[model samples]
Each structure stands twice: as structure tokens, then as C-alpha cells.
Target: MLVFFIAHFVLHWGWLVLNTKKCFRRNKEIKADEIIEAKHTAID
Candidate 1:
């Protein structure tokens, strides 16, 4: 029973880390798009 609980906790934490990484990557792409758009607007 103790082993099962430990395995479950480890798996849960690993999943959280993976999710946070994906979220951070998505935010970076969005920020990049915003910068590109601003540059285009400034030139026009």
C-alpha cells in the first residue's frame, strides 16, 4: 500500500511539471506573435 501511494504521488507531480512546461512554451509563442505584430504596426 505504501509503495502504491508513493508511485501515485510521483506520477502526479511529474504530470504537473510536464503541464507547466507546455504552458510556458505556449506563452512564449504568444509573446513572440505580439512582438511581431507591434513591429509591423510601427512600420505601417
Candidate 2:
């Protein structure tokens, strides 16, 4: 029973960490795209 509980906790934490990393990466990409767009608009 204790082992099952530990396994469940670890799985949940791993999922949360992976999701957070994915979200952070996506946000960074979006910001980078916005910056590029701004630079292009400025040049034009």
C-alpha cells in the first residue's frame, strides 16, 4: 500500500514538472515570434 502511494505521488509530480516545462517552452517561443514580428514591422 505504501509503495503504491509513493508511486502515485511520483507519477503525479513527474507529470506536473513535464507540463510546466512544456508550457514554459511554448511561452518562450511565442515571445520570440512576437519580438521578430516587432522587428520586422519596425524595419518596414
Candidate 3:
């Protein structure tokens, strides 16, 4: 059970990192902070 949990956590973290990188790459002109804010706004 612990191993499964750890695996899930690692995958989730990796996905988040990759997703963030993709977002950054999508807009080279925008700053990181702006991209983050735009993401949050789109989510909300």
C-alpha cells in the first residue's frame, strides 16, 4: 500500500512538472508569474 501511494505521488509530481513546463513553453513572451496567473484564472 505504501509503495503504491509513493508511486502515485511521484507520477503526480512529475505530471505537474511537465504540465507546468508545457504551459511555459506555450507562451515564450509571457513571464512565469503571468502564465501561472492566467492558468489559475482559467481554472477558476
Candidate 4:
């Protein structure tokens, strides 16, 4: 029972960290795309 609780806590924490990293990467990609779009618009 104690082992199960510990495992659950670790898994939950790991999932949260993984999710945060994924979101951060996705946000960076979106920002890059927006910058590119803005530059193209300025050129045109």
C-alpha cells in the first residue's frame, strides 16, 4: 500500500513535468512561426 502511494506520487510529478516541457516547446514553436509571419507581412 505504501509503495503504491509512492509510485503514484512519482508518476504524477513526472507527468506534470513532462506536460510542462511539451507546452513550453510548443509555445516556442508558435512564437517562431508568428515572428516569421510578421516578417513576411512586412516584406510584402
Candidate 5:
């Protein structure tokens, strides 16, 4: 459960961190592909 929470929220947090600047400048436009790509990078 703890690991699940960390994995879920870590990906969410990473996505948020990656898009924070754009979110602040424009709007909450989350590019999920980028998040997925990041996950792939980590997995690799």
C-alpha cells in the first residue's frame, strides 16, 4: 500500500513539477505523453 501510494503520487508529482511553469503561465494543460515518456525514461 505504501509503495503503491508512492508510485502513484510520485508519477503525479513528477508530472506536476514538469508542467508547473507552463501551468502558471498559461493554464493547467497537462501533457500526459510527457509524463509517460518520463516514466519510460525511469524504467529504462
Candidate 6:
């Protein structure tokens, strides 16, 4: 029972970390695209 609990906790923690990293990277990409669009608009 203890081992099962430990395994569940570890899996949950890893999932949360991975999800956060994915979100952060996606946000960064979106921001970069917005910046690029703004630059193009300024040039035009």
C-alpha cells in the first residue's frame, strides 16, 4: 500500500512538472509570434 501511494505521488508530481513546462513553452512561442507580428506591422 505504501509503495502504491509513493508511485502515485511520483507520477502526479512528474505530470504536473511536465504540464507546467509545456504551458510555459507554449506561452513563450505565442509571445514570440505576437512580437514578430508587431514588428511586421511597424515595418509596413
Q: Evaluate all candidate structures by whole-model CA lDDT and list the values in order.
A: 1.00, 1.00, 0.90, 1.00, 0.80, 1.00
Per-residue lDDT of candidate 5, residues 1-44 (tens digit): 99999999999999998798767655433456667789999999
Kindly report which residue pairs in candidate 4 clash with one another. none
Off by over 4 Å in 4: none
Tell me the tens digit of each residue's lDDT in model 6 across 1-44: 99999999999999999999999999999999999999999999
Candidate 5: segments with Cα more than 4 A from true spot:
24-44
What lDDT is obtained when candidate 6 is compared to the true structure?
1.00
Q: What is the lDDT of residue 36 in candidate 4?
A: 100
Ranked by TM-score, the better of candidates 4 and 6 is 4
Per-residue lDDT for 1-44 in model 4, tens only? 99999999999999999999999999999999999999999999
TM-score winner, 4 or 5? 4
Number of residue pairs clashing in candidate 4, backbone atoms closer than 3 angstroms, sequence gap of 3 or more or interchain: 0
User: Residue 1 lDDT in model 2?
Assistant: 100
> Tens digits of per-residue lDDT for model 3 on 1-44?
99999999999999999999998787775677798999999999
Candidate no. 2 TM-score: 0.87
Off by over 4 Å in 6: none
- Superposed by TM-score, candidate 4 places the C-alpha of residue 11 at a distance from the truth, in angstroms, of 0.4
Instruction: State every prediction's TM-score relative to the real structure.
Output: 0.90, 0.87, 0.60, 0.89, 0.44, 0.87
Better of 2 and 4 by TM-score: 4
In model 1, the clashing pairs are: none
